[model samples]
Target: MRSLIRQGADVNAGDVGGFTPLHDAAREGHTEIVKLLLDAGADPNAVATEAGDQTPLLDAIGSGSIETVKVLLARGADVRGNDDAGWLPIHEAASRGTPEMVVALLEAGADVNARDAGNETPLHHAVARGTSQAGSVQIVRLLLDAGAELNAVDYQNRTPLHAAVATIDPSAELMRLLLQAGANPEAVDRHGHTVQDLARMNDNKMAPAMLTRALATARRDTGRSR
Candidate 1:
């Protein structure tokens, strides 16, 4: 690769799809190659046209390449850079449930509540893409601890709790966690669907009951606080 650069190869040359050498290296998790490309003067923040205008940092996070992410960050990549889809590296990290990556991005100044084009935060992606209820619960706890807004609404006006209840197999524990983190069970979506409405629509038997109990508890807590 160094030989090619010395031979007058354009380090920033893009394919027909606009993916530069850095995008390839970063997407494939080639940490060393990424360094070489950066040293060759590859644009660290170059957006790939075929890949939804995603920066190399977004690609590295999508591929779960933490080492490559570090390399990009060290070379002055944009930590807050988003793809054409409006996904930040932190959103990808949270969606993948990689706590270490989440911590790394957070330390590098990734916004915990940075909304995507759809107005969804990393917490929203974390819950929506969670492979298991337990894993989703853990990610939620991590984001909440990092000051994620429990009541952040998406484009549809759905909170994380709304997303949780709409899951194929909604966990009462997940719902409880959001409520405890100050999510409003009474919040409605664009179609005028509340968390309980989503629970019923998704046929999540446990969620409606749980949401009801949570709402009652929240009301009681408010009353007591007053």
Candidate 2:
């Protein structure tokens, strides 16, 4: 790669899918190759001409390497840049990257409340993606602490709580965490399903869902709006 760069290779050349060498290196977490390409005048914020419009920073987050993320940020990667899916780097980190990655982006001044094409915030992605998995809860907390609107609605008019109760995580901890954070229990989605209604509908015939039981206890304990 260095030889090609030294030989005057067009470092920013894109492939058929509009993936440049910088995009490939960032996606692969090739920190040194990334630096080489950037030094050769690669556009850090260059969007793929394809439908996704992925920038190198977005690909670096997919690589899940904080070092690579840092390198791109230092090279002028824009945290606000969204993909074809309207997801920012912060949205990707909140949905799947490590907590450290989210923290780094936040420290770099990424917007906690930035909206996507669907108007979903990083908070929405943090709650909606995956199954309230191991790091997911922490990501949720980070967004909340950063002042993510607890009830920020998406294009579907669904809040993070709406997603938490509707998803099939089964742990119920995500819902509990949101409720404790002051999410409105009565918030409704575009389909008009309330958080409790979504929880009940999500219950299988085998037995009631853990989320239902957790919500019941929350209501009983706090006498919250039913």
Strongest candidate by TM-score:
2
Give candidate 2 regions above 4 Å deviation.
130-132, 203-208, 216-226
Alpha-carbon lDDT, every model: 0.81, 0.82
Question: Candidate 2: global Cα-lDDT?
Answer: 0.82
lDDT (10s digit) by residue, model 2, range 1-226: 8899889999888998899999999999999989989999999998897849999998998888889999899878998998998899998898778788899899888999999888888887787664545688788888889999998999989998887766655446677777777888788888988876776777543113655665666666577444
Model 2, backbone clash pairs (residues 3+ apart or across chains), number = 0
For candidate 2, list the clashing residue pairs, or say none: none
